[model samples]
Target: MSAALDQPAAVRLSLADALRSARETRALLVGPGVLGETGRLFREQFPGRRAVVVADPETRTVAADAVAAALAAAGIGTEPMYLFPGAGLYAEFGYVTRLEASLCRHDAIPVAVGSGTINDLAKLAAHRTGREGYLCVATAASMDGYTAFGASITHEGAKQTFNCPAPRAVVADLDVIRRAPDWLTAAGYADLSAKLTAGADWILADALGAEPIEPRAWAIVQGGLRAALADPAGARAGRIEAIGPLVEGLMLGGFAMQWTKSSRPASGAEHQFSHLWDMEHHVHGGEAPSHGFKVGVATLAVTRFYEAVLACDFERLDVAAAVAAWPAPETEEAAVRRMFAGTDFIATAVTETRAKHPAPAELSAQLERLRRDWPALRRRLQAQLLPAAEIERRLALAGAPTAPEAIGIPPARLRSAFRRAYHIRRRFTVLDLAVRTGQLERLLDAAFGAAPASTAP
Candidate 1:
């Protein structure tokens, strides 16, 4: 993989080349007026298949009606639209089940007509009904699940990524997306910003041999990221020039995830914070916070963690002593139980922690590798990450909440999340690195001013 990375940079791919590289998605039309061409694109991608428009009450007004009319004009057969309530809609299993029931009654392909929540619900529902794929008419420059495989839905009180194919086609009309509420676009910008930390996490994992970076996947997500993120102020103000790249960046992330067959290409520890909050049902202002907002705050937190890790002198580390001090399997399990004591997700947490928990021998080997690779790894990570203050600046300029309290997470709770989030996923990230080296608590103290109560047994 490093050999591939060392090769001369490939020319940026055209949209056609990108679509071909994706595992499932076949067509993408993104422009100011592409919403009007949805029927034509759908016909080109799914000839002779009837269609059903899936949306909520608000989106029905936003684009669903126009989509239905477009299909009719194109002579495509259409089923009655399946409308979820505009309010209280979420990506949860019950909603998926309801949408599945509606989809099961028709043989038509679902044309999802909203952003993150609607797309996820329709993607999972269509997959459940044995449909080859669905069409996504994006209404906002929100999160990047549009052309990505799988759906992030809450099931059994935990946020889990259910295995499913992405939409066969996607249509993002910049005119519609630009008209979306400012915060929605801001959220999209922040979500895209998280790729910085995510990329750094991937570099760390690659160095540790936990997960090696795939060159193609890395290129797809990272190539246009900085340019896309360059004008957060313009994006927040709904400028097409800024929103265009923001949408493109978000879409490219999905394509990278498609190429990799995993979200590792686009997600890392920052995403874990969002997932942990989802499982906890954390709410602000009487509603669950938007995914991008949670992730924006988490990205800053993780960036600070990276700063601490980067400052460490790994060359002087005592690998033998660290291995000897590593927690036993049972001790780790007990700590996980303590961290999740009142939640129904304790079992899930325990299972995930145990899956990635390294034994003494394995810890020694991994630590030795880290010690050996520290210099090169540190340089790579430094190249990939932005300063925490700079990330906060971009996020604020984009109109996203810059602090945890802005999204309803108190400082103490956020501190606790630094630990709890680690146990919820088997993914190897900076959090895992900190824990293995006995630096997590110290990192937390530095990032949060003081560490919260320990969950350690």
Candidate 2:
């Protein structure tokens, strides 16, 4: 019965720190072979609750027996593990419904023995299906959803995030993660790298007096992002020293989302690209790309957009004419439908586009704001970007897809995705900036021209 995070020298996001700093998540136990005692850990964190283990066929092999055995050792009451059907499960509404149906009242607290998909199901089932808080035994250094409050699930042919709490506690066994797919580790590297650009978008939102970024949450995640992403090769290699921070850093991103109650701190325009792909699915040959890999390429695209923006002299731009020329709602609606054609995502696209499309009055106000604050905003945006070359170098080292082509997205689709992405969420990203200022076409040219070479490992 050891507490993994208690070891000072061996820990990155210590259990004490997780308990203290994370807004909703209670405890964290991350160490070599720590998952062997998941049952005891669960009992300590959520005593008197009937523990129900949930896993898929593959995840069960990872830790089901160990958790069941540990619960037995702890003399805690438990039900057999509820095995979900999956070769690999997609987080969609249907699957969430199935998970909800699988549970019973006897399952008071859930212990999810997997990564993104399983953890998302667990948290959603807890919130949406009337179960109390749950815990996670992470199996990979994959996406950051484990500690995040929002579940990114595909619903009605669209990728939508549902608000939920982070896992009550999280346990990551280094031994288990070292055995995970190399692509998963690489995806984690790519996902963590989105923070710099995401922060910049948040700053833009703040400037517009739209959705302002929270300073406290911003510092916690961004403060450690560089160290987290610095050793991408080591992380991909699954070295304990290198991989440990990768895990902690991803967890911190989740915590930031929880503090903000929104994924803005960790997701920006890059995530919208992933959502666009999820919306069509057929465009990617009906195979979903890893969220992290997609975002990595998208981050490179968005970083380039910021570069284009910073290079331009806003003083020369005709703000008055641009505001006058801002597309009417119906005009953009037609464009949205046209771009998202051959997919069910068209309806949602139209809805979000119209909702976020600025009216002339609002457009005029925003133009005045942008014109007045252009220089200061440009400086902040530039300060937040990592050199585009550096971003690609790190992604290449980690064996992640560096471009849309690497993830099975063609140039036409990627360009279309860029245009349609701002409509996916109302967030004011560089995409919105370009669109509002009549520079979207120029930004699109740069994104596609300097695309990162595919570097899949």
Candidate 3:
């Protein structure tokens, strides 16, 4: 692929260049008709091991027969770990247990044959069993959690990210993706857009000495996100041509975490919002929406937040006082229950420690340092961040939800999500900044509107 094709080309090929420079992978291939050769790939990659194909029941019915025929023709044994129907099913503990049992029963090496949840289950199971895992990506929608070094799954009914390795190689058969629901493809594009704001948040963290910048990996996320958002059809049909870059970009996003040993590069305010929504789904007894769908809405909110910041005279930003009045224990606990739905003792302890010592003064000094370095920081972001307009435009083209209302979330929920979201994860993100500064309510009001505006798309 062209270097510029990996990220937003208008922003320069910096992200693409970075990814090319940092990648340590077997390979990633996306083509219109690559599914038929699955058996060959398994044989070449693992000469003697049995191949276990893990997928959801719907996908199994749609694609399993073809895969099985190929395996049988190649004289390779195939095992299917059919998941429950629908999103978030792959992460449920029962599903994990069943898959584990299947793997143990067959002594199988897994090949996840579906997108999202199926991939996560195989990766996590492989990690636990120390078996090699591979993925045949079924869609080009959004770029995240694909080639990453972890599995974001639900354990005991709560979301958690567990350590794992990227697939041996990611094979995206674009033909399969074209047949997926348009919403899935759009969700993928939205997930890729989050990279713009996510990259900015990482830059801020690095500037504050909280995180380190890996230019090469950052470049992957930057380029991949930019490129995916730039394609007009990426917002629409989620075509094969678009899939190549989107898949490449998302794979690189996950790989960047491998390089950084952290998720700082691809997570920011948008992610927190998605996490809040994910928990709410679990709490209210509903299927969790696709990660990209929630993230698309959150990305727009962050973009609007940054835009507002750009318009403001932040010179008068009350950094110290903002941090001083940070949440107390009762408030923190309440926020956690509301946003995260539940909290374990470790999270509670961390909240209490931070609550007792609101480091606003220390953080305030850091902001001054950031202000002094804003010029360089701005340059870095300019090279990577997507403008809010472009992000919304791309999402609209993909026919994905670009606002809270599109996802059945109430306008009040958006505001509440912002206030309580920081407690969902101990990580410091844009939401933390908004809450500390007491600007969250205003920010949400601006992004989603005063009323839910049920018209949000």
Candidate 4:
């Protein structure tokens, strides 16, 4: 629909306009010297600013030093904040308190020096303290929250989504991203990959009036996926040239939803799956994996699961037959709870939601339409992601883990993770689709037996 910003200047204005139409124009500047370019842009965008560099200990010792040196060289006074390490951890209320205290302590204007959590926390802090700031260096290409005007933080030990202001400017340093753990990059790729499942879900939501879609925003998202998939090496390297577009695409994706004050553009079955996994991990005293990692596998599962559903000749069944085929609540409950054991809220949300809104007739109708249109949608998706096999191969090339077990999950745990995963978040995703269709159990059985093909371009 739309080409990503700076997607080869010669790639046709219609395409460029298409992409831009969907997203607010974000400033994406790339150069061999990103620090200087970014610093210059920062001054140009908002002048007369005192700077606070909110960084993780590792980044502060490494990337933040260079950022400080660059700002100082540019004659800007800078302050340093050695933030606590880890993703999601940095955005905690406690961390926010520490940062608020630090802001007052140094009278610093918040500017983050790391990516993902650091950027999110800094952005939140800036929103709270009314400061202007940007990201310096980091990995975490996984989550779409980076550029969105919202933050998912833990409140009272439960993961909650909070309204957050978008960054005044975002400065992503590719050098740091490429060198960081491969899981982070792979997670980022997985996040991008989930767009299809999300896109499909978004389409269904819009069709049923559950959500609205903007053609312009959809185009930009489509274009961004194309650019990311087209350049495999650049994605792995985290260089400015490669990462600039990725960050831009993510920003556009976030904006597509943010501008509309909705999340339909960037979430779907895969996100639900990821959220469930997140909850399960928390419940079992298990470590959390990257958002992208969970979404990646979830995306694959949803795609295959849906494809199988489409293959079923539903027209042959009468309404009574379909009704009888619906999954029982006890079965659904047990599966969901077992799948998402660690997170009570997630399991409860999913189980309760299905109980309240049983829409098998509607779900069946939509499945019919989806089956008829599956070919077109599949072509469109393939045009963007290639095949599922290629996506798996690319993930492997990046040294990113693929299956649940790859990320330190045991087989039984993963099975449970899949079953209960739908309960973690409030979103209309493929997991929801399976739940609504009364086919989740059979799908789970198949999942354990046959690894589905990739849906990536």
Candidate 5:
């Protein structure tokens, strides 16, 4: 099958429809120069509200300043909040704590004025401070966290994603967004592409009885994906025509996760790969890859793994023998520690693995179910997943990285990461499925070109 390279952008996403789906996100103001009306919207929507406008040093000029000025023009009180300027700023525990303090001190609603990090810090701080939601004025079409219902924060030196509320509203000014770095726009497209594999993973879990797919949540994201990503070249060129759809697609991803109260609709193994790198922090010469960039590459990797699995010969399996060979809980735990040794986030890996590792009997049952349903499961995965090469083609067209090497993840680390990626989350993923089928090492060998014994579960 050929890629849908020339399809027109889909129109399934609308601000009103998306807001209705997410219930928590009251409004989404998107268009040219929407930031100029942020104060009026804030006052009208959140009557008598004073805002603590949040931004990092970089966005303080273009985004935060406009929000503050607009609020001032509308005679609404504003206390601007700025993170200390540095490359070190991230959505981690320390930043969340500091932002929460600012919210408490100012006694104002958080009006975020940046992309991923700033938005995550603001939303999580609002939740920690007991607010149901906050607002965001997007400076760039970077990641899909603007209206997402959680925060990826590093706590206890581990990348821990905590449940939080979605943004009360999102304001994206197309004029300002068009001026953002082309890479950020391309990253937005790259991020939304993960939904293809994410939905496939959800379908696999649902098919095998590990988890049920949420249809409403799935529709919110999966429906318009094709149209949203119809023009990778346009996105690469930073054209508003293409970038606009990308933003709409990303917002829908957030709403899907919000409706389900889980990341299953927008994350799976691809996200685990990105999160693993965040915790490890050794890529790109110790400069962490952008969430979207890493996910794009990992999405391709996992998609390839899925394609092979979907086509594998299930008749070759000896279910009873495989069950007998399943790794012990203690062995998996030891492996987790060994794989993540010297890493700050090893605790998270250990915690999730211990909590999620199935007992031998349980594994046998799941494997039995999987074997019974292999044909149906295979059909569902094949239907849901796009070709890995199509994704690679799209990312390359958008000037995004399509491999581990492109993101500074050496071949050895890629192998190690794939071996342990499933341990980072207490949720089922393709990695878990592959391990269950006793084909994980084979799949990894295909991706990494070696049957490393260390990858065995």
Candidate 6:
């Protein structure tokens, strides 16, 4: 099939049009051999601006040097590149502070020359230093944060999204990305695959009147998801043909987030699992799992939970009984406290849980709406999600870990996460659905054997 024909209609717009539609980003060049145009692209976006390249030692060898050379060739003045430690670097606030210090010393725009961590650091630092926006030189097809607004940074033992604009311009060269380590490419593919569960969560939220779906933002992320994820094997083999769609899908997710000014467009319940892990300081083999790896496993778990939900006969739901059984505000807060005991996230969890906790009347209304809308909502969710086994198959083909154990999460711990994750985010998802209907413990028992804790009121 022709490339244009293979792409979803929503993303067939020219690059210029895509950039113009973005809220903050203005330019994007994604193709093989686009790295050399970095200087020209930055110049077009911000004229007469000096550049400062930010990279880790590893990325410096991979693409930063070439980026600096290109800027010099274009006669764009540059400050000395700031390099962070390559080893054990993560998206922590300390790195952002250090980068901010470096940026504060000069008025030059930053050119972030790495993947997720590098981009987030430069993004927040640039925003803090009062720069309009920075440029991004992507070295891998790792995550969708390349053009997404807000940096996911760990601060005060919680994973927080610090508000920040995406890069003014982004240049992603497929050659460099295709050459990235197999795990990195696999991680990106898995992250992109998460849109399946994310979309289903959005559909569920919309059905329950929790959060209405945004059609434009939806199209931006979901239009081309299947096509982007069609060839996991090709992505694993590092073929540009496969890498191209993968990177494009990841970028489109960011654009969707930028348009909505929220991560809701790109993240959902799957991300909640990842966030919970981050907050808990989950590490396997003395290393934290990549965001994509955690989400990949969470996607599989959420998909199975959706299957269980789909099998239920919602037509006979006892709305009045469910509403009467709902926990009061204080009862829910106490549960949140117990769930997050001995953690810094207890206060935050209590706050978020309260935000979504509904009164008896409100719960009744929502349950009525759910019972009224479930037939169609189920169809929408079924259409949005693939089978859990199929998701695992694709993730395995793409080289991502398909099981929680592979990423150092015990099966028992994962079951606990299903409930704890709900308290950490006010976002309505399948988790909330299970909780409200008193099906959470049953579903958890079915999915991961039996656990001692009661998850639903």
Query: How accurate locally, in lDDT, is each candidate?
Result: 0.88, 0.78, 0.65, 0.58, 0.79, 0.87
RMSD in Å for all candidates: 2.2, 6.5, 5.3, 5.8, 4.1, 3.7
lDDT of 5 at 299: 87
Better of 5 and 6 by lDDT: 6
Candidate with the larger TM-score of 4 and 5: 5
Instruction: Show pairs that collide, candidate 6.
Output: none
Q: Is candidate 1 or candidate 2 better by TM-score?
A: 1
Best by lDDT: 1
Q: At residue 240, give the lDDT of candidate 2.
A: 91
Question: In model 2, what is the error at residue 258, expressed in angstroms?
Answer: 1.4
Q: Model 5 compared with the native: what TM-score? A: 0.88
Q: Write the per-residue lDDT of candidate 2 for residues 145-254, one digit (tens) a residue.
A: 89988787878766777888888889899888877889999988889999878878877777766676666566667766777888988988889988888988888888
Residue 115 Cα positional deviation in candidate 1, in Å, after optimal superposition: 0.8
| lDDT score for candidate 2 against the true structure | 0.78
Can you give the TM-score per candidate against the true fold?
0.94, 0.88, 0.81, 0.78, 0.88, 0.94
lDDT of 3 by residue, 269-293 (tens): 7888887666555232245667888
How would you encode candidate 6's per-residue C-alpha lDDT over 1-457 as one tens digit per residue? Answer: 1122222234443345456658988788899999999999988988999999999999999899999999999999999999999998999999999998888888999999999988998899999999988999999998888999889998876678898888888999999999998999989998998998898888778778898877777777887788899999999998989999999889888888888888897899999999999989888999889999999899989888888888887878998888878988998888778878899879889989999998888888888888887887777777788898899899999999988999999877888888899998999999999999877888776766677555332
What ranges in model 1 sit over 4 Å off?
3-12, 155-158, 452-457
Determine which window of 10 residues in candidate 3 has minimal summed lDDT: 1-10
- Candidate 5 residue runs with Cα over 4 Å from true position: 1-15, 80-88, 92-105, 127-132, 155-158, 344-347, 452-457
Per-model tally of clashing residue pairs: 0, 0, 12, 21, 1, 0
Error of 5 at 356 (Å): 3.1
